[model samples]
Target chain A: MSFLSVQNIKHSYFTKSTAVAALSDISLEVKEGEFVSFLGPSGCGKTTLLSIISGLIEPTEGRVLLEGQPISLADAKIGYMLQQDYLFPWKTIEENILLGLKLSKRLTEQSKSASLNLLRQIGLIGVETQLPKQLSGGMRQRVALVRTLATEPKLLMLDEPFSALDYQTKLKLEDLISATLKQFNKTAILVTHDISEAISMSDRVLLFSPGPGRLHKVFDIPDVIKNLTPFEARNHELFPEIFQTIWKELESFETFKK
Target chain B: MKPSKNNADLLHKQYVHSLKREKRKVRLYQLLIFLLFFTSWEFSSKMKAIDPLLFSSPSKIIDLLFSKLHDGTLMENLSVTLIETIVGFILGTLLGTLLAAILWWSPMVSKVLDPYLVILNAMPKVALGPILIVGLGPGYASIISMGVIISIIITTIVVYTAFREVDSNFLKVLRIFGASRFQCFWEAILPASFPTIISTLKVNVGLSWVGVIVGEFLVSSKGLGYMITYGFQVFDFTLVWLALLVIAVFATVMYQIVAFIERKIVKE
Candidate 1:
């Protein structure tokens, strides 16, 4: 069975006067330890889909399964990261990182040390006692990453986590995250609008079209590019060829919408 | 480069000095206004330019304060009013927050209570004073109930709004962790709303004072409110002024205490 499977998912948001369909007939699967990206325009419900897979939102007409069990039942096994760090400003970095473990009631001395070790491994050292406001944007986001990873989730969801950072920081974080995920042999699904980001970091890029977002096309990154770190992949010669193909496919959706 | 660094340090010192000077000037102006108002009132009363009977002199009020203190009547009344105000203030805040938590816990409850909340918040709370005294009897219970009722509705409305206004994303983070509703409230919602809650506390200090005083007025019992009423009946405005002054000082002190707690609890 696939590591994570989203089956014929459909969702809608309802208000007093309107029921807006956000996602329609969405189905996808990711192999164990695979990396995939959902590349799409705004209003594509990329986030909506991510929320569904993370079990934060229930699909109106479908289900998600992780390791062959329903995703909802697999509590605390999925880690979700948002565009901005959303670290509880009142909490110290240590508190924020341990939040997941604390919530899951698995916070032991061993687990605490393991999370702190992860923090240090992620190049954030000696910042455990400091508050989120004291850190720079990149550092805070890294703290958020540590917070998410502290739970040791089997599958990770990255919803445009690097989109809020400066270009330089974003590039560096992509490499750091790609390496970390690879080192742990974890499966990850990233949602992004940046063609280069999707092509560089993902093994397979799933292009989504907007307006009740449907999967439009899929592009499989060559092993030559996929084997490299995101930064190295971005600089690879084959990168532009794949980038152009995905960009044109995304552009077609815009023109077709208009 | 060293000389330029020294210049920067010198400029920083000058800026700090200017800030201190400005703060001192503000304090000086505040003292001047306070002194001028009382000094003018005392002078006018002494010169018989104003009705001494109606607008009692500062000296007369101070003398009455001393005499009342010596006889222990002022302490008795002041303590009664202070206790009622404090108890009422704490109860009002606690009940309001509890109501807000209930509203947050169940959206259906909030929806059902929405119109009622608006109505209670809009209605004059003091108008319930007579009814409270009649119902709870002419005692501390009625006076304290007045204090609570006066502030509770508004506190509920304000606190519930604050609870709702907490970033939905924070709740999202907690939900993804599979945290229960109670866990979410304790971990994120309550801590996030501390500032708003503290601000409501500040406003409730004044509100409870209004409630307790009016309750005392309706009941005609032992309190600063009763002192004011008695002074008015006897046409001894000095006694009225003394009671008013005491209320003002204690209210200010309560507000400052709330402010201090806000500074301590709210880091940012």
Candidate 2:
């Protein structure tokens, strides 16, 4: 049994006048410690698919599985980092990072220490007293990432987390995150439209079609950077080639939309 | 090239010069404008250009203030008025916050209560004085009930809107984490709405005071409002003016306290 599995999922939205089909007959598997990216054009429901897998939205058909059992919201073990950093502006940095822990249960002294250590590891030493508004954009996203990680979910779903960042900061965080995920040995699926980001960040990339989103193509890219961080993956020769291929997929999908 | 006392004098002169330069002339302007206003009123009253009894010179009002101060009853009545306002304001704010939490918990309850709350708020608080006096009796109870009626409604509307105005994304964040509804409220909604709620309290201080005074005017026998009414009936316009000024001063001070609390609680 694969560590994570999604099978024949279908979903739709009903407006007052029309039913919009977002996903159709989607099936995929993610093994332990593998990183996957969902690449698609705009309106392709990639985010919706991720949302469904996490059980934030109920899929209209089929099931998602963790270890071949039907995935429960409790058992799904996924942490989401959204496109925007939804940090509570009123909370201090330490409090913000501890949010998931606080909600789930009271953190023990050791666990709280570990969270502090994680914050230090994220290169934000002595910033615990600052509020979200005091931090730069990059720092806010870093705190957000740690908040998700603090939940200790087995599968991390990143919903275009770095898109809000500038180029330099994005590159820096990609390195920091990639290294952190490796050290922690996490399985992750990232939804992004950036071809280069997908190529640089994932072991496999699943490209989806727009609207009634279906898997258009899948690329096996483990060899691009065998056990290296996302920063190192950029230097691999195959990275650019994969980037071009995803770009073509997007172009064709747009044409299909038209 | 010895340093002389003249140099010390020059430094002192410069310091005084800078003090005068920095201290600003705005208060002087205000005092002058105020005196000018009353000067014209005094001049007009002397000339019989306007009715002396109606316009009432600043000097006459000052004399009235002194008389009331000497009597000590004005301050006692003022204290009574302030107590009603403050108690009512605190009660109203607490009730409003509680109601907001209830609404956040169950949207349907909020929806059902929505129209009724609007109607309740729209009803003139002054008109309720007779009914309140019948129910709660004719003193502080009626006065506080009056303030509570108006201020609680203000708080309810302000806090409810603030709670609803919180970014929907915060809700999604909690859901993604699989936080239960109550947990979501504790973790996200409460903290998010806290600032606005506190600011609403600051805003309602003045209104609540207005309510208390109006309540006192209708039925209170020992408050500043009561004194004002008594003064007006006895043709003591100066006493009435003194009462109004005292109420204004107390209300402003209470409003400032609310503002200070708001600054303390609101992070950004």
Candidate 3:
């Protein structure tokens, strides 16, 4: 059995007057410590898929299993980083980082010390006593990443986490996230629109087409891509070749309907 | 010094000198405006351009105020009204906030109560005085009740709307962490709505003061409102004008105090 399994998930939005399907027959299996990316255009239900896996949205027809057993919201071992850095503005940075621990009743002295160390690792040490508003955009996003990591979940879900960042900050954060995930040995599923981001960061990229999104193709990064940071992955000899191939596939998606 | 640095210092000095002169002129104009108003009124009354009996001059109002002060009538009545307003304000804020919380807790209840709260707020509070007097009698209870009735509905509406408008993304953050309903309210909802709550307090200050005075007009004999009623009955027009001036000053001070507290709480 895989570490995480999403089986034949179907979901729809039921407004008062109409039913709109969002996803159909979606299935994926992720191994322990492996990183996967869902690459798609907007409205492809990539975020909805992440939401289902994290137990935030219930799939109308399918189940998510962690280690071959169905996982529910009660067994909250799933960490999710949203598109926005949704840090509580009123809370101090330290208090925000410790929120999940406090909620789950696992906030011990040891966990807090570890969180502080994690803050330092993320280069957010001095802003612990300040509110989220006091930090710049990149710094606030880094603080959010720390807060998600402090919980120590089994599977991490990132929904367009770097989409709101500037190009420079996004590249830096991709590096930081890659390093942190490797250090923690975390299995992660990232949903993103940036094709290069998917190619650089994931073990396997699942491509989806919109209008009731379905997995259209899957690409595995070469073994040579291993152990290289996202930036290094960008510079690999095969990088351009692979990027062009996927770029063609995505472009074909836009032209196929016409 | 470099020539550029010398020029920069001269420019800074000129800017500061102009700013100081402008501020001085503004202050002088403020005093002059008040002086102009009072002097004209006093001059008009002395010349019989306006009758002092009907429209008391500033001097007559001041003299009446001094006599009321010496006799201790002004202070006693002023304090009585102030106490009533403050008590009513506190009670209304607390009860209104509590009701808003309860309503937020259950959408069904809030939906049912929505129309009723609106209607109550729209109803003229003056019309309820006789009914309130009949129920609570002619004392502080009735007066404070009047204040509470006037302020509570609006406070509840303002606070509840604030709670509803709290950013949904913040609540989603807590939900993803498996926060319970109570945790959601305590950590996200209440703190997010704090600025709105303070604004509601400012609005309540005016409403509560109006309530207390209106109640006194209907039934009290020792508060500032009672003094105004008495001045009218005995044809003491100077006493009426003096009491009104005192109420205006008192209300402005109270409003400033609330505003100061708001600044301290919302220090952004």
The C-alpha lDDT values of all candidates are 0.92, 0.84, 0.90
Which model scores highest in DockQ? 3
Tens digit of per-residue lDDT, candidate 3, span A1-258: 899999999999999999989998999899999999999989988988898888888889989999988877666688888888999888899999999999988899999999989999888878889999999888888899889889898999899999888999999899999999999999999999999999999999999998888888999988788579999999899899989989999898889879
Of the two candidates 1 and 3, the one with more favorable TM-score, higher being better, is 1
lDDT of 3 at A27: 90
- Give me the displacement of residue B200 in model 1, in angstroms: 0.5
What's the ranking of the predictions by TM-score, best on top?
Answer: 1, 3, 2
Which residue pairs in model 2 clash with each other? none
Q: TM-scores across all candidates?
A: 0.97, 0.91, 0.96
Chain A fold similarity by TM-score, each prediction: 0.97, 0.95, 0.97
With a 3 Å backbone cut-off (N, CA, C), the pairs that clash in candidate 3 are none
lDDT at position B228, candidate 3: 83
Angstrom error at residue A167, model 1: 1.0
DockQ for model 1 equals 0.66
Instruction: Evaluate residue B44 in candidate 1 and report its C-alpha lDDT on the 0 to 100 scale.
Output: 98
lDDT of 1: 0.92
The docking quality of candidate 3, as DockQ, is 0.67
Model 3 vs truth, CA RMSD: 1.8
Recovered fraction of real interface contacts per model: 0.69, 0.53, 0.58
